[model samples]
Target: MGTDKRHYKEPKTLPDKRNKRPPKRFRRWRLISSSKAVGRFPVLVETIFVEAIIPDLVITQISNGFLHGKIPAAHLPIVDRPHLLDTVVLCIAENPRFTAPITNVTAAVGREAILTCLVEDLGNFKVAWLRVDTQTILTIHNHVITKNHRIGVTHSEHKTWFLHIREIKATDKGWYMCQINTDPMKSQVGYLDVVVPPDILDYATSADIVTREGSNVNLHCKANGFPMPSITWKRETGEMIKLPNGREVANVEGNFLNLTRVSRQQMGPYLCIASNGVPPSVSKRIMLVIHFPPMVWIKNQLVGAYEGQQVTLECHLEAFPKSINYWINERGEMISQSNGRYEPLQKSHNYKTYMKLKIEHVSQSDYGKYKCIAKNALGETDGTIQLFAIPKPSKLLNGIDNDLQDQAGSLLQDKNYVNTASAASRKFICTNFLLVLSALHRLQ
Candidate 1:
């Protein structure tokens, strides 16, 4: 076709850009802009071009004159008519990124706990919470996906995401992951530790024990809970415990307490304590009773009394499992409570007793060796006391009177006897008075 002089002119060919191709990295992109028509030609007032390439795009992006893009083109085709773009809307989005690490959480059983994940530069990507151990997805963005009602998800300003768990249980303790749906998947993990209080098992623990003296014994304590419970043994009375190795301590640790050659001194209530880091420790009280043969101890092995006087003989005895105590005469016959003449009484405390035999209106027959006996299931024991008679007060006084009379008569018949009181006579009289007092004391 021939060019018209006024309507058309020769088409200008730009030699540098006609067959130009973008670098291999960008070779498949095209640009679009607004333009104004001038006769039959258009002119560009503002250019819309991508400046840089983004290796990956997570989601959609909006542009305002500046744009981040990854296209196969170096530049857009040029136009001659009036082309302009007042506000170009080019969109480039960023992949979700973690600004802060996920924080670990800890809570006791039946309590609430929270794990936080901080993310920045999150475009349209969705964040999810997963159980690392079980590979179970707990929450996606703000929606919970787990069947557990105690689990929930929350977020603050689209940056800080939280995984909420109410009434935490031991089974819920593990590692949890906060993940983003990126090409390679971005994730951070935090641990959730759930603590549990101690609980003692009655069936597996020791109960009240009754053993013989010099025997070996073992006290066992068992408990259940998270983190495992530690067992300790302590005396309820706060007394030191003699370990099997002969070392004494106020408290012992372990599930088994070994006591070697246990004696009466070691008999009491023992406590088994179970404890963990959690609150409200538990304890069990076990009574230990040491049984032994009856033993008798005499305070006074020899006792004396005058006729028609009352006297008491006592014996202290110790035994476990209780003891049968009685008083016996020299003939080995158990003394009976006769017409209120001979009174036998027994006063007992735990494993101990005081045995008394009171002889009222004591006669010559009552003056003999008497025995106190204690018997128990283990063995029997006895203690003896010799009860001797003393002269009556009236007879002793008469003898003293006769002896004084003879001494005075002999002094008066002495040829050298002085009518006036002499030093020798006064001395003898004082000596005689002292002798009479001593005799009266012995009679009483």
Candidate 2:
């Protein structure tokens, strides 16, 4: 078998190597070719077969297998989202700034004025107005613009801010502020000047003048102006008289002149001057008339009465002016004639004039008619009242004796004394005899 194996050939067949899987298509490839002699025994050999070709299988399957794109698992990364930077943006539509001079403004007591501010480049910002002295925020934004009714805010056509004041008063004169909500930056400031006008001269009417002697008189001066007017009084000699309390009497409260307890020397042409800071001072001259009634005269009267009785009498007086005065009459004489018994219930003063008399515990002596006499510088008046006296019980002796007799009889009956006093005395002397008789009686 070994000698024959030298020439014998096997039939040709594909090599087993071809049956093994080929390397990946992306790897290298090789080609194999074979030829055989016709008459000789068929020869067999193993060789590799490969072709260099485009990878068309995968491309063809992908193109023809599906309609469009395919969606993978949901684990995809996000690429687009919005991010927040700053939270809020504040902007002012207008910026307020201004300047005001101190000398130019003039305000009346009951008038109003405005302070103007130029606003520009606001840029979404909020604008507010405030009073500098009071630190009160007057307006906010475009609103007309204050919680206070006295203050108002207005915007001009040219974008200017104006502060309007109503009924301007003395206290309204001050500095004001134009504020914007720009932090770190301070608010703008403006000033206001209020000038008061001089008070006009007040005219004096006949009704405004009062005339009296040894009494108070009031003179009123009527004037009108931005500032209230002050009044002063001067005599023709340009001398100022000492007032009731010795203070300077030239100027009275409001526009008034007062003269207390007028005297003949005080009667003259008096000048009433009215002045306010603003204009020419004005004055008025008038003559003072003093007329009063005569002083009253009182007639010291007497009234008589017994003890334990009420007495009333009248005090007669004659005078120019009628006034009231009462008399305190006791016994037969006027107790008020001297300051010791009769005292003034009220003292006389510059304002009031009256006197009073009072008597308490009226007795029979006070029963006589007493009088209240009213006297004034002009005239006098008298009034009288009658009183009656009542006798005390001691004066009635007969009735007292009768009461004593009845009391003695009542005492005797209470004592049970049926025997006479002489009989009682005799029984005391016969006590031994009575005892013997008592024994005989007992035996019976």
Candidate 3:
């Protein structure tokens, strides 16, 4: 037994292969093939994060749950140390995806606006903010790339990114993009709607309108705003508006309110209202006026005045432009205010006028036909009133001093029936004389 133990010896210990570093090419290949961390372009891993990945690979293993990439390495155990590479590899295992979609943002002008993009498992990929319509890059990662000083970018926990716009303007409204620089360029889009209260363009819109009756008229209302406002035409007095087809509506849609043939019934202040579901809708007041020639009408075509009596003849006139009103005698002479017996007066409201001719001390000369005339830019019109003498009952009774005088006086005192008959006969004689004179003048 002592002789067999003499040749025993300890075997040589072999070096640990896991502790030895592999070749540079072999390490790169291992990182590229074994994990999706490097992806197609390995260089991106070195540039994306705040704590960038080292180009030279650092051997590490997971500890607890968190990567603890920034913590001191001296505190971690050698067997269970953690590094940023583990974080990259974990994030790479699950591709970047939008946790929540970017929502459409409505912002008022001159106000601050923020747009957020939420992502998960972003890994070494980059997040960029872009203006889709303009193809302008606003921000890349944590840096603002646009020259606009109002723009800014912020990131939170490597998951949420924000693009801030200060003092937003009308030009900033459009489609915005939140993009992830992935293999196929992952992207999500949202609209930036800048809401502005309706504003009517005064130059293009209609002002106070003055057109002739039975003429075509167009009222235009132009507005400038986001979402393109809609225009409505309405009466300011809350009256129903009449359309070209004879249909009446409370409110008419479209920018132009076309009236095929305008009339006096349609003259008033029209409201041009503009709205697009925004606050503080705007409106403009446009006055529409209808114009026509002068016209005259008289209630009584024949008037009677006795000797030593006073009488007033009246004429009602309508005209677009203010008309000059006066009274003319049977001899075609305009009645003058200088005369102490004849007084011509006129009162007007809008397009209507009341013309009066007061004849004091109505004698035989005043008992004849008188014309009330109205003159304007459009045309002229006149109305005639026949003035005839009505005999006084006392004078008629005195003229007949016979037996019938008592009967005539009694009848005249009862109801003035005799005077009424005499007035009728005088009016007939005057009318016949005027007709014969008119015929003779026409022949001449």
Candidate 4:
């Protein structure tokens, strides 16, 4: 009766004054055991239980069984599952990439050259400019400008993209591409050369150039410019001339001017200036004149005969500018000249020009025709020679050998048979009969 005397009584719950703590109860079972001893043979004994505590509790018991989500049979070993987004996508696929190629380009036909392209990660780019054989679309995306009226794109307030070629022809020479899409490719290529300048076509002067009278004049100015044309010689009171001493004044290599030997106080009026640097410079003007003529005269009379007999001639003149004299008419007309004889020979030098008329011992009256007179101060001329006064041939062969013996004694009458030689011989009996027939024909 005492064992049945169990009193069970206890029921008191009150403490909910808006609660303060106590509210964590989730338990269904708990039991865990494990032991191992090899040398002593405690083979196996393992058990583990702790209900409902798995939020990933050993991966929810390895996803509840049959190696469900795998790994957890309990030899205790399993870990490996943290793929931070595939290791950041394989470290960005083993990084190393960049692209941009093309540089330094220039052009000049009508003139204007400036085309540059260079880029490297120009962040979020679309930048474009093309003409690569008229793809024509130049520049887009970054502020849209695609009207190639000779192209013009300049931005450097940190935007960088300059390609200005306003006026460049020859069909705008080729290849000008600058694109940037950037992924595995970005590009640049510039090459344009168009330069043309040189054209000048004609200029001239020269034909019988003569300048004398104090002497100094050279007028020759030619032109045709392209890369050549530069000649200057001036004097119209703008003086500049001293070219001559081996002369070679250049503007194309020595365009002559040697006013050194020219006086009349150096006459003026001359200009020859040609410029090829292009810009109006061309000139020509010439005027120079001077004259000369005066100095000549000679004439001194003289004539005589006999003494080997032969002489004749005359000459007379004064000075004013008309003269040219010379005559060795056998030497004898004293005025002044030497070496062809004419002594005391007056007049030394002043351009006596030269003159002649002389005769003093050229018997036979100095044989005819003699005269060469030339006068000046403007006028007078004459020339002639004629003189014959023979009588010297060994006294005319001794008077013709006494008139040929008085005409052979007036036509002989044998006049003693011309001195008797014949008459006396015929008497020699025909001279012994011709010397006895020439001695019998010389004894046959």
- C-alpha TM-score for every candidate: 0.62, 0.31, 0.55, 0.21
Candidate number of the best TM-score: 1
- What value does the lDDT take at residue 119 in candidate 1? 94
lDDT of 4 by residue, 155-236 (tens): 5532456677878766777788777664454566777755433232234543334354456555565665444666766666
Number of clashing pairs per prediction, in order: 17, 42, 0, 31
Report the lDDT tens digits of candidate 3 across residue range 1-444.
Answer: 011223323224323333334334332122222322233332222201112223333323333532223322222212222332212231112267899999888998788889999999887678999999989999999999999999999999879999899999999999999999976789999888888878999999999989998999899999987768999999998988888899999999999999888887787899999998777789999999988999888866766556877778878998887787888899999899899998898888778899888888889988889999888889999999998876565755454336545544444353323124456654654464345435435545
- 318: Cα error in model 1, Å: 1.8
- Please estimate how well model 2 matches the true structure, expressed as its whole-model Cα lDDT: 0.47
Which of the predicted structures, 1 or 3, would earn the higher lDDT when compared with the native? Answer: 1
Candidate 4 deviant stretches above 4 angstroms: 1-108, 111-125, 129-246, 250-444
Best by lDDT, which number? 1
**Weakest lDDT window of 10 consecutive positions for candidate 4:** 85-94
lDDT to native, each model:
0.73, 0.47, 0.72, 0.42
Q: What C-alpha root-mean-square deviation, in Å, does candidate 3 show against the real structure?
A: 12.5
Candidate 1, residues 297-368: lDDT per residue as tens digits?
876665656788778888999999898888889988889897479999988877889888887888888889
What is the Å distance of residue 169 in model 2 from its true position? 3.7
Comparing 3 with 4 on lDDT, the higher-scoring candidate is: 3
Q: Which run of 10 residues does model 1 get worst, by summed lDDT?
A: 36-45
lDDT for position 4 in model 4: 17
